[model samples]
Target: MWNPKATVENALILLLLTLSVMAKTVFSQNCQNTGCPGLKECCSSWGSCGIKDDQCGFWCFSGPCNLTNKSYGFNYNVSAGPRGPIESIVTPSLFKRIMSKVGNNCPAKGFYTHHAFISAVKSFQAYKRTVAKREVAAILTHFAHGSEGFCYKEDKARGKYCSPSKKYPCEPGKQYYGRGPLQSIRWNEYYGAASIFLRLPLLKDPDRVAQSPEVAFKLALWFWTTNVRPALYLGFGESSKRVDGRLCDNLHPNDTKNLVNQYVNLCKILEITPDEDARSEISAFWRRHLSALMKRCASTRASIITGRYGLSFVR
Candidate 1:
């Protein structure tokens, strides 16, 4: 029994010696006092210093530390709206992030990987300043509905969209129902114009638009820049008038209201309030417009607000 205690003490001493040696090696090799570039410099998991949130927050070894909340003192005032400078061009990553909220349920999932869509959006010179992101959001929202998530062709069509226009005649056995983002509904007019602008024989090979992601987005860009941008600058009502020419007319009384709801939804997704406060104004707009428009459409029976466009079920 006396000998057993001595053996246990010897083992404990050996273990302590090994641990001390290992600790010294670890400290000398890795834990030396190294300094970063600046006090703001964040030490990332990859052992590099960076300024972006991706680098400093989530990528840091210590986990997300809000440097802004530290003694450095940075505060954001959401109540006052975007106080910081806005980006003129919509970066691909930013666009993808925003669009994901809108088309989360879409079949293709997200924005197509091509320069055409971004290029076309950037070409809108008038809307490039503060309203660029808003306009782009609006266009994408409409496209999400019009093309059903940028589908190349309409899913359901009775016949080939062959136009009988003599000026832009449909080639033999060719159909131009709804190709590309704006659907490019008719061949002789819409498809014809796209073909001329793109110089890709879109008239004969209408499927090129559907097949090529670049061409598909290009068609959408052309439509938005040429036909819709001017009217849209004024408001949704003017934009509808330009596109359909009968916004809330006898034919579709609730159509404008329904469309407004869609626009509001888009604005909400983009975090855009009416007066630039963090508070959303679209809800107020909906309350004022939705009920009256629903009543008017309900009586006419011509235009009915359905759940498809985010309208609540009518009583």
Candidate 2:
């Protein structure tokens, strides 16, 4: 009548077949024909993901794409470090405004007169090539200072004594001539930056900066990352303003916007963007060096944003 053994065997075979089909469906579902969101999908026909090239696919997430699995087709790691706090605070629109104001206007001629500026640019290039964050900052600081008056010619007696000065000294005004990225001026700043950041005895001999531009360039990087950055980002100089222009009571609505602009301009020079993913990396760079100043100073955040985004008051 009823063959129980045969029926059981048939049922088992059917179950196995169903399980195999289900497994195939699940495996196929891992990848899609179209590229996944947040990830640059490659080989839609093959159901792969990754950067545009024919390399392996990367796992896609909501916020940022993970590139760990991808092969080394590209040279640089687009996403390797933590994003900075400035990313959230700064915006694209604000950065454009800042760059517009601080347009690259240094002279392209005169080697002797433009030596400092040239050195500053070279220092920046070195930083980019090396990815030395502190060095990059120092060079920028030097640039900021040099841009103002590092090698400017001042009239001694309002054109009456236009033949340079012996008392005032024709050898580059110390206080007024801080030109470079971070705008470091005064012997104190230069020496301090050199000593602390670059670990050189530049403070003892101020002429070293002019005499040895390479050494000065390295010192400049140190200063911007360590000193100037702290003063701008985490210090009470610019970050703590309230609406009424007081620490608790003073605030400028435009201040935040302005700071963002400055950051964007810096990004343009450095070729960085303020996307959500990139924010952490940039912030980490700022936080590591400027920790003490940021903690001690209240308005450090505001100052940083303003320095990068607002009118730099270089002159």
Candidate 3:
């Protein structure tokens, strides 16, 4: 009876606002399923849809035109897989050596000694082989480069350490001097590489390197595929040679040897022949691991597409 045009415009505006709010609510829920596809739940799980925060436990990325595309959660499946046989073969000897360094109580602190490190590597291999469906060599390559900084503090504090370089000083006040099977550190090299590859803010908060091992590993893998591997290929003709140089030059000769031993342990765990040469052995190991990892990622993506679009599940 009054102004029909004005009323229609107001109603449209309200409808748009309501739709926005509803969409926001739907994307903010937590991802309950561990098996959920790539980042479907990571962005929303942090309590605000598409809101990126360092402490949110996920990395969000938007598409061209600023449309939200996806978020990535920390990968923890690396810790899963077959361990018994690998542990039985490598644990006793590796543990004896590690205990001599970090002490017998190291495992209680979530700080894996050398033997524990080997066990983890083997477990990771198994995970890649079975669940991730990625190449073992690629996985091993990721692991080797990613595991760099775990022992830096322990080595330095005990007077048995050498610096990666005087130009890049180690900050003792920082608890995450890079420890673990992966030599992950808070250095610019790692952080920068991770930022670019994972599209995450790894460099902004250095503490995540220590506080979250799974996150650290994800960063490591990202760096390896995007930067480290290419650099290694350029530096040395053979991938194994590059890995050996990284272990010996970037870290320590002993650390390199220890990692090799871990590789042997992993092979034992996987029931595969442990290649004699340090470079070849790890190269083969990672090749197998990467194969599985790629498969896992593909599977995860497929599930997400199916679920989001209401398509029939493929796997």
Q: Which candidate tops lDDT?
A: 1
TM-score of each: 0.52, 0.30, 0.34
**What ranking of all candidate models by TM-score puts the best one first?**
1, 3, 2
Error of 1 at 156 (Å): 3.0
Each prediction's whole-model lDDT (CA): 0.48, 0.34, 0.36
Model 3 per-residue lDDT at 84: 39
- 10 residues in a row with least lDDT, candidate 2: 239-248
What are the clashing pairs of model 1? none
Question: What is candidate 3's lDDT per residue for 164-258, written digit by digit as tens?
Answer: 43433334443323433444332344444455555655545555544554554555444344323432212111222222212211323344344
* Model 2 lDDT on a 0 to 1 scale: 0.34
Please give the range of 10 consecutive residues that has the lowest summed lDDT in model 3: 60-69
CA deviation > 4 Å runs, candidate 3? 1-108, 111-181, 184-186, 227-257, 275-315
**Candidate 1: C-alpha lDDT:** 0.48
Q: Could you tell which candidate, 1 or 2, scores higher by TM-score? A: 1
Question: What TM-score number comes out for model 1?
Answer: 0.52
Clash number by candidate, in order: 0, 55, 40
